[model samples]
Target chain A: MLKNYFKLAIKVLGRRKFFTFVSLFGISFTLMILMLITAFLQTELGSDAPMTEKDNLVYLPAISIKRAVKDTVVERDTSYQEGIMIVDSTVTYPERINSHSRSNPSYYFVNKYGRDVVPAKNYSIYNNSSYDFFLNSKKLTFRALLTDERFWEIYDFSFVEGQAYRKTQVDNGEAIVVLTQKACRQYFGQESGVIGKEVVFEGQTYTVSGVIKDPKSFHVYVNAEAYIPYTNLPPAVLGGTGLMDGFEVVYQAHTPADIPKIKKELEHRANLFEEFRDDYATYNRLEMMSYTFRERYADNLYDEDDDPAQNLKTVQWLLIFLLSLFVILPVLNLVNLNISRIMERSSEIGVRKAFGAHSSNILFQFVFENVILTFIGGLIGFILAIGMIKLINESHVLYETTLGFNFKIFFYSFLICLFFGVLSGLLPAYKMSKVHIVNALKQNQR
Target chain B: MISLQNINKVYRTKTIETLALNEINLEVSEGEFLSIMGPSGCGKSTLLNIIGLIDEPSSGNITIANQTVNGYNSKDMAHFRNEKLGFIFQSFHLINDLSVIDNVELPLLYRKSVSASERRRLAEEALLKVGLKNRMSHFPAQLSGGQKQRVAIARAIVGKPNIILADEPTGNLDSAMGNEIMNILLQLNQEEKTTIVMVTHDESMARKTNRLVRLFDGAQVS
Candidate 1:
């Protein structure tokens, strides 16, 4: 019975060549668009990375007075346009004074009689232009704690020749620079071979100890041209200049299961610091590197102020919506064609009924017919999707991005096609199955 | 054998109620050749449809082969139709995309009582009986009207159905072709002893059957 239904279905489809082509084309186009969108989303979201252990790495920024302040008021003296003035106002005093001070000022500056008072004397207020000059002159530095050697354990990076910065390198205060392959090829020409050479950074020449692999996380600072020893950084950076110095400490949890425990311990340790001893600095604010790509990268995309991750999220949603619209429109077209085809076969259905075919047999036959057509369409759509991806890749709209047809996207497209085929064919099949044999026969007579 | 008791089929719309078959009671014995003759809208085809188990009577009991089939669901009806009955339509109803032999083998495909090879052999034999063995590979569109009707007859008898229900099987053919198809039906009835029930408007076609039943305005004429 099933074989007969299939044969009849094929015959019906063959008879209406134009209509069959239209339905197949509609299904193929929809599936192709859907596949392309899925591929684009997968590439943009960095879901293609092989790093399964990134969830445990937490990016810990050093708690300082800078990040805690609500408003940083720098009182400018109108007396002498560019000259300095010592503002005695409480609002601007802390900011102006803290801006010039390092993490541990006692180590660098001695108390010269009354000139350099321990805490109060270190505070200096300058006029607008002088303050600007002072702020500009002060070098910005970053500090991080490499608590575990496992910090480099979770990511995949290929070393051109040497290895990553070892625990011994950090313990010995050896200032070694780890150059990413891109950075190496950029600074020293492709054939320059700078693996064991000396490189200059921040007025200091550091020996090229090892060339570590480039980090694959999209949010990782790819421009870290040189990585010096954590211990070799000046005391000023280690302690943080003022409260706003760009000092961060990163810790790698042994496993993802230990992230909560590590976060809690780190927060407890941060609360013990003198600056955050009071309720001023909130302690438990650990940011994960994985989440930065998801949440923080949006603000960094176009403008430094806007989060790039949010933009990516919005774009993802827009692409999804567009894909859905594309799929739905074509499916609607197919559905319309299917209904018309069913109408044309009404007499055939009546004859089949007059021959004692059951309703389910009719329904199954029509659905199977539609699925066969859709399966063929799906193959064509997959080919089209690959072509589209190749075109997009060649266009380079996604600069520095790689997009291709992956298995997940293919599976998704196949499922979408099957769903579309059934949804589009069901109503028409039902209607055709219910065709009245008497009316059909009488109509044929006329 | 088939029997219909007080069969009434009414087609109802929101604003109108059209009666297609009213209180219809019919019976056809084994090896009987019956014809229901009527003009258009006279319920001849409707009565054939009800007897064929393609349409249900609004109020009546239909018994076939001593089994009550009035309330048979779709599956039961399909089983009965595939196993015990075959249909031939006025338009020949051969699938245009299928060749003559494939069309003949359709009923056997549904019945599944025979292997594919056996079905093909039986279909070829049936087509030869209808004098279309030479046109086995020709599609319905390539065949003449009489040839198409003959292929439809081959399909109707290929399953060895006890009853063949033909709805104006020769309506679209010329008188000569109509007589040819009627002769084939007569041969099947006389030789194979197949019960035949047919609906036709032609008086001469009605006379070829053993019994002629007349219908008018969805009712049987006394």
Candidate 2:
């Protein structure tokens, strides 16, 4: 029964040359679009990232604080009446000093006995500045890491010429630099040549001890092309006297399953700070790796008032919806075409039915034909999608990002083709199978 | 052998009802050559469709080969048709894309009793019997009208059905070609002793059969 149905189906298809071409063309066209969309989504989700241990890595954004000063004067009349003469008065304020008391004061006053007076000089002071001030301060600059050497153990950054900084390097205050491939090319004209060379940054020269691979992870900040010893942060940064006064502490869990416990522990640690206890306490937030992209780049992406995580989630959803639209429309169009073509074979179906073909047999034959056509189309579409992705990657569309060919995308597109082919063929197959032999034959005769 | 007892077939539409077959009773014995003759729209082809188990009677009992088939479902009827009957149509109804041999082997593909190679051999023998052995590799479109009908006749006999049903099998051919096709049918019945039933509007074609049944307004007249 199966053989007869397939034989008849092939014969009927061969007989109607124009209809077969149209139907196959429609299916192939839809498959191409679906394949392209699958490739794009896969690349966006970091499926092409070369690192084998991506899930274990975490990125931390450093935070700091510094005090800033602004001066203002006010004038007031002592006398109640406007016409009354008022005695003139002048006030003096002392200059600011560090809380450590070892740092020099910007201003001071000497009394008649040659002792410094508290209010002799007219200088105003402010204290208890937050992390943002330190980060933006021009007077003090340092590379402040709130983490230790454990960070290197989590991420596998490739070294072209030299090794990663050792734990002792952090402890001994070694001023070493790890240059990314891009940075190496920019500074020394070659990735290997950058090793042992010195590059000047912020009026200081640091030896490029190693050339590291570019960070391919989507979540990492692109600007962190250089690594400095975490423990070597200057005394001014450690004592809250420099631009790096605030420390953005990050710790990685041993595995993804430990993230929740780690997050809870960090929150408990942040609550112990006294400065974060009052109304200002709401500003303190601890997040996991999932939120790092938003937490780190929120300010640069949107207005300070907008929620960064919400924006990213919205964009992700929009992309998914757009991709689905690109896939579903062509699939539906092909499905309609398939149904119409099947309808045109109603007479052939009736003849087959009269010849002892069961509904299952008929359904199988139709589905088999569709699967064959779709499989061929899928192969062509996959090749086309790969070329398209390569072309788009080389173009300026996604600047600074690479779209590598991904097997997962190809497999996903193939699965999509199979699913849609079966789903689209169902209605037509059912309708074709149920064709009444008598009526169909009579209609054909007419 | 075939028998129909008071069969009625009515076609209904939203605004009209037409009876294509009404109160028909007929029987043809095994090994007999029978012909059904009538004007167009007189239900001659409808009667053949019913006898072939391709159409259902609105109200009646049909018995083929001494077995009642009136209440048989589609699957059972299809089995009955494949095993008990073969059909040749006025248009030949050959799948034009397939070579002549493939077209002849179609019915045997539905039957599980024959292997593919055996069926092919049998189809080749049937085509040889129909004098079209040289044309086995040629597609239906590549054959002349009489040759196409001969291929259709070979296909009908390939399954070794007990009864052969031909509906105006020579209507598309010239008189000489028509006579050639009629001679093939007569030879099959006389030599193979297979039961043959045919429908035609041509009286001379009807007269060639061993027995003639005439129908007017869906009922048998003689």
Candidate 3:
């Protein structure tokens, strides 16, 4: 029975070429857009590449310092006392002055307060910046991260050539660098054979010790084209007293279960360091917080004035609204088209009913037909989405980022198509199935 | 093989009630070929719909093949219709998307006991009986009015039902094609002893049947 229905459905789709085209256009286009968005979200936010093992890591990305100062204000009362050349009374009150500063945590702040406080298996402190290098009298800028040898252990960089610098090399402040594939091509005009080659940046020459794959563009914390040792940074950059900010920290716990303990310890350290004195000045209050990958991204969405939890909720609601709209609008369009299309076959429905088809059978047939349509449309959308992803990668719209299609994305797209099919097909199928036989038969005469 | 007791079908709207079939009481014997003659909107099709179990009478008790079917649920009615009755419509009512053979196989598709191969064999046999075996793959649009009605007859007999109900089977055909369809009905009645109840307006067609009943304004006259 199902086989017959499937055969009939294919024939019907072919019979009405214009209607089929219109329906397929709406379905395929909607699914393609959704697939593209899903691919982007997966690449940017999903567990892939260097951050694959990020579940057990906590990051301290910023430092917030607040202070309140007391100033004396004097109020005098004079009039009749002035006539006698004497003051009657003088009052002094303390005025409150509040100031707050927030930025990426400095190396000095992380080393002095954050290092011993968090109970973790390992940790790394890194500073992110960009530097200009002269190549044949042409200046090119590349993003760079300066860190210790422990950074390599914490990060899972895929090296294509050679290997990362050793602990001894970092400690001795050796002028060595690790270049990403993109950076290697830019500096040496070749992907391989770049290891052990020297590149000059701002009058300083460094040999490339390794060539690694470029990190995704959205990984702002670790997406550097060039990686060098922190010990090699200039004295001025390393001389920060907490006010100067360029560094961040990542702590790797023995297991993800130890995250709460680490957060608690960091909270205690923040409380203990409430009043901090540095070369810049003294702060009356300080807040040092740790975040998981999701929380870190959410934290970046708002400023210090906005509540992070509330911001996350708002963002979540917005995303749900957008996705629902994306699905609902196309579903509604398909439903309308299907109703009109099915209504044109009322005579067929009447004939089927008269020939022993139950209402449920009719319903099943229509829904099955719709599911088939959606699957076809989904296939077209999948091919189109892959082509779009390739185009985006080739065009470098995301700048060194390459989005990919994976099994997870494919599974999700399949569900979306199924959901779309059922949602759009149900109402029209039910309406047509319940049509009175006499009325349906009469439709042919009109 | 078919019986109806005081069947009443009333169509109601907000401010009007129209009687489509009024107190219709009739019985058809085994292998009896009966024809109903009526004017337009005179309840011929309405009565046929009720008898075929496609429309429910407002107040009636229906019996077919010695079993009371008025109280049967939708599924039971459908199963009973598939097992005991076949239908042919004036417009042929064939699904235009399907081939002629597929249309003939429509009734058997609802029968769970019929395998796909058996259905194809039965459909081919029915088409052979109708003398349209060569046009099995052609769609309804490719066939003439007479050929379309012949395909409808093939579909009606594909399930080998005990009774066949046809509404204006040759209403759209010419005198020659009409005679051809009437001859097919006659042949089926004589050879297979299949009970047939057909609704028509032609006196010549009615005269050829074993029994004739006339209707005027929702009531049977003779």
Candidate 4:
């Protein structure tokens, strides 16, 4: 019976070629767009290399401080009856926050509340007034970071040669640097076994401690092309009076469950800063190794205590609303087409009914017919989406990222097919099933 | 055998009430060729539909094959109808999208006990019985009026239902094609012992039936 329905649906759709084309076009185009967006969102927010432990770790994304200062002023007020003048004093303080602070956060704070595990800080090498490097006299300028020695513990950087500079090495303020494989190839013409080589970056001779695969920019904490000591950066860039406030504090949890304790301890320690520095209040953002700046999702994404993926749901929901809107228009179009198409089959329905078909049988037949159509359209859409994704990647429109189909995309496609099938099939099938036998038999004359 | 006790079918609107079947009581015995004759809009087709279980009477007790059917749900009615009744419409009511063989095989497709090959063989036998063996691969649109009606008859008999309910089966055909249809109906009733309830206006066709039932204004007269 299912086979017969499918066979009949194909013939019926083929009978009206133009209608089939229009409906297929609408379905396929909408699905392609949906799939492409989903793939991109996965790249930005999904768990990937270097941040695979993002679900288990948290890092300070950024911080700011806001304060108000009052200045006294005198104003003259005139009161009516006797034309007398009175002097009134008022004080106004406008709120201000310093969004820009020194890149390196205070090491003193980390050493205070910090446990035995990972603690690291990075300075932006992209802001290179401090150092200029000549790579084979090609004058290559690239973004880099100067991080604490334990930065390697928080980030899962896969190395090609040697390993990160040690905590003892960092404590002694040694000039050691880690170079990405890309940087090593450009500077040394080789990627492996360059641990003892000395290279000059930013007017300082630094020993090459490691060579690693370049991290995707999604891992903002470790996306740099090179890393050196904060001590090696000119002292001018590292100047903050009270505790060297400003770089990200990177920490790894002992286990996935330890994230909350670490966050609470960090929050408490941040709150304590108010007691020591009277006028300052703390306002900082966190991006867990388990989460990214882009996909700061709900707390439950990692099955953890706090929501490290902040405001991500709002963005995700907005995307859903837009996709639904796209889906709805095409579904409405398909519904209209289905109505006209099924109207032609009213006599067939009446005949079926007369042959002992229940209303439910008629309903299932119609729904099955439409579901088959939408699923076919969905398959077409999936193929087109894959093609579109390939085209987008080749076009370099979304640079530094390659998008493709995966299990998540495949699952979403399946759901879209079902959603499209049910969404477009219901009203038409219901309408077809409700067809009065008498009227339907009469319509057979046409 | 079938019995309809005190059946009434009313088509009501906001301001008008039209009785299509009025307090009708009927009995169709097994293997009887009963022809219902009436003028247009006189409830002949409505009565046929109700008897076939395609349309429910407003108030009635319908018993088919010695089991009460009034309480049967739509699904139950459908199953009983498939097992015990078949239908032929005035337009032949063939699915134009399907081939004649596929059209003939339609009834058996709903039966879970019948496999695909069995359905094909049964459909082939039915098509041969209707003298459309050579045209089995042709679509309804490709067949002549008489050929289409034969295909429909083949569809009706494919399941070997105990009763065949044909509504103006030959109304759209010429006199020659109509004779061919009447002959087929006569042969099925006389030779195969299939009971038939047909609604028609042709006086000659009515005379050939074992018994004639005439209705006027939604009520049975004779």
- For every prediction, compared with the true complex, DockQ reads 0.37, 0.28, 0.46, 0.55
RMSD of 2: 14.1
Candidate 3, residue B163: CA error in Å? 1.2
The sequence of per-residue lDDT tens digits that candidate 1 reaches over residues A1-446 is 55655666677777788987887788788887777777865664453443343444443322223332345666554444357655444344242212211231121111111122112111111000000111135533321222223334444455667666767876686767666665566556562367679765556566776675544333332224445555565666444423333333333455556655654554444333454335334432211222233333442343222233466577556656877788888878877888887776666667666565677767887888888888888888888888988988778776435576887778878888898888889988887777666665554332
Model 3 Cα shift for residue B35 (angstroms)? 1.4
**Lowest summed-lDDT stretch of 10 residues in model 3 chain B?**
B88-97
Q: State each candidate's chain A TM-score.
A: 0.61, 0.65, 0.88, 0.74
Q: Positional deviation of A434 in candidate 4, in angstroms? A: 3.9
Q: Write the per-residue lDDT of candidate 4 for residues B1-222, one digit (tens) a residue.
A: 989999999999999999999888899999999999999999999999888888888898888889888888878877988898898888788899999999999989778899999999999999999999999999999899999999999999999999999989889999999999999999999999999999999989989999999999999999
Ranking by TM-score: 3, 4, 2, 1
How well is each residue in A120-176 modelled by candidate 2, as lDDT tens digits? 111111111111112124332222222335445545566777876776876676777
The local lDDT score (0 to 100) that residue B181 gets in candidate 4 is: 96
- What TM-score results for chain B in every one of the models? 0.97, 0.98, 0.98, 0.98
Q: Give the winner by DockQ.
A: 4
Residue A153, candidate 3: C-alpha displacement in angstroms: 0.6
lDDT of each: 0.67, 0.65, 0.85, 0.75
Which residue runs does candidate 3 get wrong by more than 4 Å? Answer: A67-99, A274-283, A301-313
Candidate 1 on B120-163: residue-level lDDT in tens?
89999999999999999998888889988999999888888899
Cα TM-score of candidate 1: 0.74
Q: Please tell me which model should have the higher lDDT, number 1 or number 4.
A: 4
- Sorted by lDDT, highest first, which candidate order results? 3, 4, 1, 2
Output the better candidate (3/4) by DockQ: 4
Model 4 lDDT tens row, A95-141: 44334232334444444434343322221111222245777567876
Best by lDDT: 3
